[model samples]
Target: MPEQKAADATPRRLPPGGGHRGGGWMNAGMPAERSMNFGPSARRLLGRLRPQRLHLVAVITLAVVSVALSVIGPKILGHATDIIFTGVIGRQLPAGSTAEQAVEGARAAGNDNFADMLARMDVVPGTGIDVAALARVLLLALALFLVASLLLWWQGWLLTGVVQRTVRRLRADVEDKINRLPLPYFDRQPRGELLSRVTNDIDNISQTLQQTLSQLLTSLLTVLGVVVMMFVISPLLAWVALVAVPLSVVVTQQIAKRSQRQFIAQWTHTGELNAQIEEAFTGHELVKVFGRQREVEAAFHAKNEELFRASYGAQFISGIIMPAMMFIGNLSYVVIAVVGGLRVASGTMSLGDVQAFIQYSRQFTQPLTQVAAMANLLQSGVASAERVFAVLDADEQTPDPAEPARVTRPRGRVAFEHVSFRYAPDTPLIEDLSLVAEPGHTVAIVGPTGAGKTTLVNLIMRFYELDAGRITLDGVDVTTLRRDDLRGRVGMVLQDTWLFNGTIRENIAYGRPDATEEEIMAATRATFVDRFVRSLPDGYDTVIDAEGSNVSAGEKQLITIARAFLAEPSLLILDEATSSVDTRTEVLLQRAMAALRSDRTSFVIAHRLSTIRDADLILMMEQGRIVEQGSHRDLLAARGAYHRLYQAQFSQPVADDATLEPASVAT
Candidate 1:
């Protein structure tokens, strides 16, 4: 192989979203290495919930009502405490004495402050505890709390529906984006990395929303409601309790800034590690064949370690916020308690009011702590959202023509007219190449690996648009036709056969879901699939596993051929289609293909020279250009590139007029 050819054949592994196809992995470093913009990612993630705005409003309204009711419960309980205290003091006074007499008695004892506090208590002298009033106040407090609990539960229920619906729409958008992305986008992205974005990252976003959204909303509302209630009970105590607000904000901000980066790194490493694991499992047999298990394990360990480090760093850094916030809150609580106690003792405030203030202080700090704890989850979720957004924002392939041309009576006469294309701008793969495959002709393309043989077929399918020229099917430009319209008339069988986890019959009928039983049987028989399928205990109903490990490689190939045959396309593409089958199976497939190609134009990419001896046209390509073209005998008579390739394969020279018989090529 030429140097360029060898380079093309080498498998290039890239980090997630590393480089474009022809640009190679060296063109740019790993995308995961870059730092994420936390603000924008978080905002965009919240935007996904916009569709559920009405539900969110309902949730917020419920939370506000619930928090308001909860706040009033503490105040109502404080009022009940005042009533009980007044009743106790009244019972202690002399029977039949007026409240003024009790206050004057305390003042006469040199306890003027106690007299002043007693004067404010509104106790009726000579009375026992007001049992009816106490019962009424307690009942009111209980009812308020019960209503609050019900409202809180309803709010949580609404928030759950909102979060799930938002995440569902996001998942749908990601799926649609993946389908619209160009083939080259997938080529640049590792299968595992892509899967992580679609599965793991999206799942993380869902979990983040589920865990944080309702709790954050409720916490914030509770904080606001508590502040107001504290002020109502005692403005001095409320101000003292709020001293921790700035400190808590500073702590959360500092910790979140550091942890967000680690969270991004953590998810990025997660994706990279998943890619390695997927690669290892998918190619375990290859690793064992080459005795590279140790190397594979080492690579896996390196990736795993990176993931562990990122996760540990993210957790450790974000973990500091809750404890730090709690410390500040505790300090504020102690100060407020001391101040409120002094005021109560000095007779400037009631004991019941001081008690309620303490309760409000605790309520204030608890939500702050809860919010601090949720910081980690929020950071992690936004990191995942950034990754999912990357997929949604990727550039898609050019859209099909607005007014698509139709192929009413298909004849499959594909023509490449001065077509020029490359995977990357700087590295040209095919330049100004042209070819014509007439209807009902079989064109065989033979070349060394990376000689643009596959690229030629890919162009006809319009998998990638031509950089400078146009291709046509039946004298109509393919670009003008809708991609679906063009592909529907074409059937392709690749070297690596793919079978979904389903029955063999379902796999055969994949290309034509509405295929009749007789039509399906005819296709299977024509492609030699029935011969082996009938031998299985389940016959056509035999199930192929996810990896298709249940059947032999040749059997898989036969099933794929049968699938293509069932489609009965006007244009057929067989790319090393018989390379996996045995010699006997190859002969049968060749005969079947010959019959299938009777009136349809077919392009066969093959390495075996014998396969193309009967082809209507033989193309010898080298370095993205056709070096020779003609019938096999004509190419041999010309003593050109085709002749040399044929001679090299057989290891024997041939005379100009020598007739080479077609023989089954061993896989």
Candidate 2:
């Protein structure tokens, strides 16, 4: 089997956001990574509310009261129906009965009054209006309705504050989790997919809590409240309404279960599409240079089409719930009406009772329809919650030692003693590797592609833990010291330059936030960054965009060099740091690096043989092992693997006179 470098050294296969589809967005398609469990995720999400339990209790209480007020209004209206019927029948009022007393007596008679009906009944000789009783009941109903609306509003207002706080904490947790995660996590996962979990997923949870959460509580109470009222009116009719419950459950469960998988697919495809878009846009210029625009568009179209299919399936399937529920509810309604009419006619129930029963039945089925309708959204919220929790629960980097050794001033002496590591457990990339670099020495690493040159640098920096190895700095084990302290003493400038949106001064001072203005200028001048910054309109204050697109790639590299200079590290690692600059700038950067490396140990990994020809030591690696180690002159004299590589990089091919094919360089 072919050898592979350490995991971090391997090229990332997925774009920044191109997450794996299995186990939804949370798992990111890694078989070793764990997907979130819904039950645990939900419990953790609700646990966030523990701090605001009192507020949540108040919100629930208010929701229940609001529904209760709305539920009882119909019953009160039924009483008024009886009053109007009695008044229209010309019932006479007793002598000396005041309007208020007559109204009370009318209510006591168990049949309520309507003000308009009572006024019209005055024309009959044996009848008189009972306006006071009708007005009292109507006013009470109106008051209850108004008060219930107020309660609903208040509950929503309180919930808004609570949900906002919950979302704030969630966002904070994700931000912190990003820092705790291992570098390997980001290598396999896209920044965009992780961002989707942090921003989009958390936002989804917030929306559900703000809007759907309150409605969920109200719908549940309405269903319960309506059920009790149904039984109270007539158990026979109640049984008929209850028939819709199981049927609704069966239909909703079947549809929701199918759509749930589709919902997961929809989000997974969404993450994939986002990752693709992010990669395409990030390297749009590369796409144009390589003439792969059509290919990119085709890939995007395929992912988009998949997204469309998943979205349509989830939505179309879930959409069936509302209408199916409505049909079931209507069927229950007809049965109740027919059966109830027979019972009323047979003196088993009153007209008012039947009227109340019909209203309660409508109330019962309405919430069922609502819950069924929101089934998709609820599942989406749960899925989002699961993804968010996955990040929170992901394994963090190895913790620092309990009693870490303090490095007061790291001396640059470094050593690797029988170090062995692999990208995967079974694939050995490095075995029994050993090397030593004394203080203030320049140790250059030279190797072909896939020779684990960068992997050696990663191991030295401890970006990845070794499978079996002991690396030491100044005779002290590097792992025994706190990572922050160990890393603070080392500085690196890589081929890929990273600069955030900020002023030139801010970007340079990023590693040393408290550096003084004079100190910054000194470092900038040392790295020749001051030469360019002086030409810019804002000098060092020029604001760069997120990608630093305003500056050329070489300029970005110069700025990163200046950043490392300001860091004043004891050990420096340059991984083809001058690959982007022109020959003139490269010469200047070499002089600056020589000056920087005078007192500090430096490790240079370069393909350009001329760059490392003057180094104190040179190590030639092949297939994850150091095949040759010596000074440039000694390697040149030995004529081994390093000699062949140096000759390939520097030697030109002879022209062939006989054949049409170009002559090949001698090995």
Candidate 3:
């Protein structure tokens, strides 16, 4: 919670080059308010901007007109004041002045009469402030103001619509990439860290669009318009406004640099904190059983403290930007005031012009402050953008080939021909090992803890590519087939089955999205989960808590097995699949596995020797090699590695079942 703000705020600075792990060189750029630090790269945000072009064009057009009207409003008021002192009021009209001039003269007379009634009046020479003139000028200004407001409102509405659409696409794309990302990607990142990148980072960008972009755009346009007005009013004085520009720029650059560093730290710290929280929660049971509560708490406290410090540091630096800008803006106002007043007093510039100049100065500063405020958001947005871009930029594995050869759904004949593998370059997990599972065959893999039993299943699934060999299904190389197509034909019931936060029916239905309720129940009966499920309050509709925490471990396994049964894949994989429940559940799972394997190519890796005693081919693996292979009865007769392993597992007295955990139970 202490880091919530930083985690939520969206930092703009990222490790340069979107480093996969180690931080890299950072490019210097403005703090995030206006657009991305790099103008061209920032244009990417503008790509989405075009969708609201009509509304945005109206908004900008109104802004320009409003600024022009405000800049001239003061001049009109000053001119009317001066006119009261001229022939319109004090001086009689020249003998043959035109009738229109006479009418203006009459209006001035009325204004002077009203002015005299109100004692404090130093009128200028040509204000033209008669009732009709006054009404016309005020109405014009009001119209312009209303137009500006309407445009801004419309633009805001447009921005919200765009934010929702952009975030939706960004999140979906990131999630899809995560799913397809090579497994090596996960080896380099914590899951929590990647989650922060895809979720928190994208959310930050959305917040920026909602709150900060308007300020940035307005400030920029104001500065531009006011600069033109300043030049028209008084060339020499216009230079003074320009002077503040550079000063503001330099200070902003420094602020941006410091803030970027803090933001990067904040993001990094937030990711670390989330990582700690997830890890701690995942292992909470382990901590309690081992009585390590104090240790875990102390570690969490340390991470929490770091998170608070990082957040506070990031916020403090970003917060200073607005006030500093305001101070500089106020200083510019003072300079413009003094210089314009002197020009008017010397008669070098008209009073009306000086008045306009002063209004222009304030207009320029307001946007300057806006641009400044925008810097904070700009910084934060760029940070989020960079992270999001980094993910999109990741060198994804070579995509599946286009125009790949196609065949009907697989008939489940698998072969590994001289297949050799290693996770890292120097370490081999499997070497030159060839095996096959023709249809309707049960191949069981037995090995010591470090043996590559699981690796074989992964390769068969093509989760990792083969090295120095080829794997084929029905004589078609797996690599030649579409990844989804290949995997769809394979169904795996991994040891740690994950259940979504949904009902029993939904979870079973997930394996085959179109499965009917009757089919789901049939799967449940096949997997021996129906009796227990029927006893639950809502049967199949019962809501599971986070990670199926509401259910007992045995029950979760049964439901998971039922899901696999529902899938009815051509190739079935049991990767120590029953290693996390009681003996009763283990027996149910074995029966379920038996029923499902009847008409498929099943690859099961077994820990309990009893489970694989009837396997068609039992292979004993040591390190990465298959040292022996045969039927269970055949291996037992050979009395080699498989024989010794089987004897060691089963020779124990049945009494040891009380002390030893069941085959379905795991850490």
Clashing pairs in 2: 16-190, 83-112
Q: Residues 182-203, candidate 1, lDDT per residue (tens digit)?
A: 7667766766777888999999
lDDT of 2 by residue, 396-453 (tens): 8888899999766667999999999876566677899999999999999887776778
Using lDDT as the measure, which candidate wins?
Answer: 1
The C-alpha stretches of model 2 lying farther than 4 A from their native spots are 1-44, 91-129, 343-348, 655-667
Candidate 3, backbone clash total: 20
Ranking by lDDT, best first? Answer: 1, 2, 3
Worst 10 residues of 1 by lDDT: 1-10
State residue 434's C-alpha deviation in candidate 2, in Å. Answer: 1.2
Ranking by TM-score: 1, 2, 3
The global Cα lDDT (0 to 1) of model 3 is: 0.69
Q: What is the model-wide C-alpha lDDT for candidate 1?
A: 0.84
- Better-scoring candidate (lDDT), 2 or 3: 2
